[model samples]
Each structure stands twice: as C-alpha cells, then as structure tokens.
Target: MNETYDKRIMKQKTHRLLEAIAALIISAIIALIFSFLVSVLSSSQVYAQRVAGREGLYRDSVYRRVIGQGSTSLSCYLSYPQGGSSVLRGYGHNAYELGKLGEFIRAALSDTLIYVRSVRVCGYCSVDGNYTSNEQLARKRSLGFMQFILSEYPFLRRYGIRADWVGEDWDQLRSLVASSTLNERDEILQIIDRVDIFSGREKLLMDLNGGAPYRMMEQLFFPLLRRVELTVEYDLHRIIEERYRRKLNDREFALLLEQEREKVRREERLLAEQRALKEKWQADSLAVEETARAQQARAQQAGAQESARRADEAAAAAYRRRREAAREASAARTEHRKLYPLWGVKTNLYALAGLTPQGERTTFMPNLEIEYFAFGRWSLSASALYAYWDFAQGEFWGVTSYTLEPRFWFSPTGLCRGLYTGLYARTGDFDIRRSVVEGVPTDNRTGTYYEAGASLGYVLPLSRHWYLEAGVSGGYRRVADKVYDVEQDKHYLVRNQSQSRLRLTDIRLNIGYRLGKKTIK
Candidate 1:
C-alpha cells in the first residue's frame, strides 16, 4: 500500500514538472515571434523603397554578367583503387583533373550569369569481382564521390543531386580486348562471346594459360575501367539589351560611401554588382585556361599510351615474321642436304651408238660417259665409244668415238635429277662395209666423223646413287666417207664423197650412278 501511494505521488510530481517546462517553452516561442514581427514592420517601408530601385540595378548586374563570357563546363574523371569502392583522389590524373572540375563548378556557382542545373557522376567497375558486389560497389563509389564533392563545397549540398552506376563493364572490356594487340586476344574474346553471365567465366579467365592473360588484362586495362565520370550541366542567363547598359560614375561611387537618396544608393549598389560580375568573369577565364591546360596534358598522356600500344603491336608482328622465317630456313637446310652428287658415271643402255652406227654397219660399240658436277647447275662430261668386233672373215667394221660436253641444268639441284641442255663436240673414226639405203642394200661406205650439237634431256632419279637419263643431240655432222662399189672389189675405194649435213648426232638412254659428296655453298 505504501509503495503504490509513493508511485502515485512521484507520477503527480512528474506531471507538474512537465507542465512547468511546457509553459516556459510556449512563452519563449511567443516572445521570439513578437520580436520578429516588430523588426520586420519597422524595416518594411524603407526595404520596399530600396528594393523598388534595386530591380534596375539587378538588371544591370545581369547584363554585366552576360558580357565577356568564358567557358562554363566542368567535366572530369575520378578513379578508384583496385577492388575497392573508395576513390583514390591522387590516382592516375584524378587529382589534377578533378581539381579543375571543382574550380570551375565553385566559380560557376558564384557567377551571376550561370545557374548550375545538375551535378551528375556516373560510376563503373571492372569485371574482376562478382556482379552483385560490383553493382553495389558502383553505386557506393558514385555516391561516395558525390559526397566528397559535397563535403568539399558544402553549399552544393542542396536538393536534386543524383548519381548513376554501371556494374561489371563487360562491353568496355570487349572493346579494349578488340583494340588491343594482346597475344591471347582471340581466346579472351571467345570466352567473352560464349560464356554465361555471373557463371564460371571469371573462373575460366582466372585459370587460362596459368592466368597469364587475365593478369595482363588486369594490369593494363582494368585500371581504366575502375573509374567515374562527372558532368556539371548549367543554363546561361539571357543577354541584357543595350538600353539596360550604363556605367557607374565617380559621383555615384562616392555617393555609395556617403548618405544619399535611394537613387544614388541604388547606383552605388549597381556599381558594386558590376565589379563583382567583372571579377567573376576574370575568375571564370582563369578556370577555362586551366581546364584547357589540363586537357592538353591529358591528350599528351593518351598519345603516349597509344604510342606504347602501337610499339607492342609492332613487336608482336616482328616476332611472328621471325618465326616464319625460321621455319622456312629449316626447310631450306633439309632440302640442301638432299644435293647428292659431285662426280657421276653412266652407260647408255639403248643400242644407239652400238647398234645405230652412222653410214656403216658396225659390229658393236659400247660407250662410257663420266661427269664432274662443278656446281649444282653446271657440269663437265667426257664420253668415249670404242668397239671393234669382227665375227666373220673379211667383214671387219668398227667405230671409235670421243665426246666432250659442258651442261647447264634447269634447276638448282639438277645434278642428281631434272632437265638439262648441253653443248657437245665429238670426233670419231669408223670403217664399215655393209650399208642399207632406202630399204635396199647399197655399196659399202666407211667414215670418219666430227660433230657439234646441242642436246636436251631429263634425268629421273632411281635412287640417291642411280638415275635414268634420256637425250638426243642435233646439229651439224660431217662424215668423210670412203665409197666403194660393192660388186667391184672388197678393199678398193671407188671414189671419195664429202658428206656434211645438219642431222641427229646421237641418242642416249643412260643408266647413271652418282658418287662422292658435294661441298655445300
């Protein structure tokens, strides 16, 4: 019972204390309102009269503000550190460029002719992280950057300021990869074109070629991606007409310091505003000049980056050319090792010189030819045909021949095989008795012959050691024939006939062999 009574007593005391505090607050509020009304009423008449004249001064100030205008743009880029949402002001031109943006914006706000409409920042993040986290990071980065701007210029903390965001900028990555001369650019693009969103694409990149390509991209391109763009848009005040233009005089300027009528005071105020606008214009010019300098610097940096990229591309192209040249050189060496012969010997298999004895019937004639390939495309050869065989009495017929030829091959390694042309000179001695002319047995004819001709032939390689060659020679052939009447006498020369003709000298189908190694040139 005593505790309940004590609680009721404390509650009543608490209510009385609350009533007293409320009454004090109401009294202070009424007193403040009464003082505000008294001051406003007392100054209302003079304030209205001064404001009426000040409207014209305001128009004049606006005109001064509009004249000699300069640039009013504030565009800049801000970058963030790798994988972090916070901005790095000192990072990669962010400090200098963002400084220019702030200077222009702060100056624009104070200028009379410009009204800042919006301050916008667009944020982007690289694809190094997950999509959801990157999206949130983009928003946070943009908001954080705007907050930094606002904190720097607290007057900009007004209503209607916003920031937009773009997360995991894959399109930017694709464009960078396309324009870059990366060694694995194709593989990177393939994964980007074919991989799924928020899937194992990043994983594949993390594991590609021991992560070398991914690391390269991260080092070179991702820094550009982790950035934000700031744009400050504004509207300009209209140009005040000529009639509103007037200069402030010395009297008016002096009257600005002394007590005078409202008109003189208004002129003084107008002069002050005009001076303010002129100063603001000067400040704006400086900002514009500074911004232009920054832009020129940025352009130089971009040019340097472009030069570096092109240098890398040229290096890659040179490397590829060297690789191709190396392969071609290896092939050339292998083919050079196949050059087989320096000295060669061959026997003509066809019975050409043996069975095809000219102007006489020879018993047998076998020929041997030896060649020394001086160069792969050139050779010198000597040939001899000496066969003297008699099977019956009083039927002795034989031919002896010697030939020297210098050959030119159609190919670089034609010593072992291919087509060739040669100029040959030959001298031979022969004696024969049985002859046939136009399908009828005629008188015996014997001859000593001299020949000079060009020969063409193709050599087909049967092995590294052996080849099959076929050729025929045609040129001037001279045969000194000792003519004898067949019915008259066996060993009697009836008459001497001089024989000179342009005809086939010899035909050869040779089985040839190559020996010894050639010195490589």
Candidate 2:
C-alpha cells in the first residue's frame, strides 16, 4: 500500500508542473499580442497627428500672406522753426544736423529692395493766418519737400510720392494743451473736443484764458508738426527665399509660391476697390456741379425760379449722400486692433474633505486663496485653510493653517487651464490625543507644527468664469506637543517628538472663479 501511494503522489506532482508550464506559455503569447496591438495603435496616432500639424502649418502660411505679418517702416523727425522754409537745407534752426539728410537718402536708395512706398509732408504755422492761407502755406511746404526729394533722388520719380498737409496740427496742439501746466488746460481741451470745424477750434482756443493756451501751443507744438514722414516699404521675400531655398523641399517651395500669388491677388483687389471709390467720388462731384449750373440758369430765366429752387434742394441731397457713402467706405478699410491680457488677479474659495492615514479623524477644510498671475504662465498664491475634524470616538477639534505656494503653468496664453506643479510651505497649530499608558486615560496634547511640501495639480475650465481643480500633496511634518505626566500631575514640553514620515497633508478639490480679462491661445 505505501508503494502505491508514493507512485500516485509522483504522478500528481508531474501533472501539476505540466499545467503550470502551459499557463505561463499561454500568458506569454497573450502579452505578445497585446504589445503588438499597442505599437500599431501608437504608430497610427503619431501619423494622424503629423498630418494634422502639416495642414495647420499650410493654413497659417496662407493667413500670414493674406493678413500680412506687419509692414516694416522707417521714420525720422524733421524739425523746423516758425515761418521757416520746409526745404531740407532751409531748415535754418538745425542746418548742421540737417546735413545728415543726404546720408539718410543715400542709405535708403542704396538698398535695391527698399521701395519708397509713400511720402507725407506736413506743414504748420503759428496760429496766425485764416484757414485758407494756412491751407495754402501747408501745401506749399509739402511741395517744397517733394521738390527736394525729386531733385536728390530722381530715380524715385517712377514711384508715386503722395503729399498730404494739414493747415493746423490740431492733434499736436491738443497734446501740448493737455500736458501744459497752463491754467486754461481744461477749457482748451473742452474746445478741442467740442469743435468739429478747424476754424472753430482755433477761435475757441484763442478766446480761452486770454489766449494763453494758443500761445503755448504756437511756441511748443507748431514747430514739431512742420515735417515730412517717409514710409519705406522693403521686400523681405528675396532674403527669405534665399535663406530657405536649400532648406525647403520642392513641396514647401510650391506652397510658398502659391502664398505669394495669393498675396498679389489680394493687393490687386484692394487697389481696384480704391480706384472704384475714387471714380465714384469724382462722378458725384461733377453731377453736383452740373446741377448747380442748371439751377443758376433756371433762376435767371423768367418763371423758372421755383424749378431752380427744387434743383438747389436736389444738389444738397446728392452732396449729403456722397459724404455718407465716403464715410462708410473709409470705415470698411480701417483695420481692427488686436488685444491681449498682460496680467490678472483672481480669488478662489474651496471646500475640501479628506481623512488622515490613521482614519481616526475626518477633516473638513475650507480654504480662501488669492492668486496673482505674472507674465501669463507663473502665479503666486497665499491661502488660509481652517480644518475641522470629527473623531469616531466623539472628539472634535479645529486647526488653522496658512500656505504659500508658487505655481508654474504649462499653458502660455492664460491661467486656470492645464497641468501645474508647485512648492508649498505650511505652518499651523493642531491638537491630538496621546496613546493611553498603563491604566491612565489618553492625554490631550496641543501645540504648533510646520510642514514643507510639494504638490501636483490639474485645472479644467467649467465655463468662462469658473474652473475646477484637484490635487494631492505629501510631506514630512514636525510636531511639538505638550504631554501631561498624570502620575506626577504636571505638564512637560516635548519638542520635535514626532518622527519624520511621509504623510499626505492635503487632498484638495476646488472650484474657482477667474477675475479680470480672460485670454485664450
């Protein structure tokens, strides 16, 4: 019987080992299949992302050409004295400095790619002439500057040089009035704002505060406006193409060429629109002139005076319509300004509940925090947490803690979205019960403690103004408690009595409201 039992036990052991070997082999096969599937999925996802990224780059290239990155421009200030000639050499007050104008023109002409896009010459006089004479003087000054440019750079004659002049530099005058310490500053500004006509503005300024404001503007501001502004547009395409010719492949070059063609089309379309507007304006002016002639002829003829009156009314109506149309067309061509938020401040109130590792107490922490964002990505916050705990043994207590944290966000455009990590320091007071010793009851201990820790958190936007956040923090804490020796009936101080162990200080879920302007990237 003993021999038979030994044989059976040996057989059973062999069967069990075979079964174990089979199971391990099957597990290996399953793992290989899973790994292969994961690799295939990962490769597909990477390929999809690459295609999407390429498409986005293509779109952005077109947008950059259509809207234009920005125009590159050069500007120089030309100052003139009162009643001075606008000729470059005739700038008598700064003749020695004006000699540099030749060098400036030489440098601009030296660059083959630099094109003189436009020239604007503005002239000013002391608030001395009637609007008509002031307008003529301004035009003459502009012509003087234009003649100088033409004489020096005759090659620029092919390019259209536009001359614009304002009889009075009202904008500059108002700026001077605003900055001046004169007693009539407010009255002058009121006049500048209230008067729509140039003559009315000048008259009002002359009437205020014994015309002291007008004198201030004439001495300080008018000279600053007697100048010319030359806008030089340069072609960077040649430089960019040369730099990237060897780097970009055929496909990229083709796309770049397409973008350039689109930009040319856009510019042509804008020019056509401007030409149409100009033609319409001219036609409207001619029609108004003809109507005036017909009205005058009818008024001279007998019994046609009433018809002339009707023609006069119709001319006024046509003039009003033409002005309105011009205003609308001008508004359509104006560019919209882009805005961005530089800094922001926000306040958050959160209710957090969690338990200590011992599970002896359940904590309810209410937190109030204020955060300041700087340079978009970095934020610093100061928070106060008041924690109330309920023990299973019918004991209750509260602790107050203050935390200072500095966080950095991964998103560049705004706060309150994406992942963040931060370092924190917390200091607070806590009360807890010490273990019972011998037959004595548990000792109630109270003292202050401090913790230093790090945290990882994520923020998700719930709406335009609200966000949800969750995080975990862990650190070592040093506790100093006062212990009572019941046998001696006295209390003693225990300093640094708690061992340093990794403990979870807080598990927070927060709902926050964002204040100030919110930006999205």
C-alpha lDDT values of all predictions: 0.64, 0.57
Model 2: lDDT equals 0.57
lDDT of 1 by residue, 92-185 (tens): 7778977787676645555333444566777888898778998998899888878877777776656256889988888889999999998999
lDDT of 2 by residue, 1-521 (tens): 44563464356446545643554464366446546644643552121111111112222332243225323323234554554445656454445544565565544444222323444444454455677777777778767767877787776666566666777666766787688787877887887788875547767777777887677777877666555555444333432344244455567766775665565566557657867886887788788878877776777785676887887887887788688768866753532111132332222223344344344434454446666666467788787655544444534444557789888888665543679888989898655543445644355555568888888888776544446777777787777755433334333333335545678876666665455452311
Return the TM-score for candidate 1, rounded to 2 decimals: 0.33
TM-score of each: 0.33, 0.31
Off by over 4 Å in 1: 1-337, 357-363, 391-396, 414-416, 435-442, 485-490, 518-521
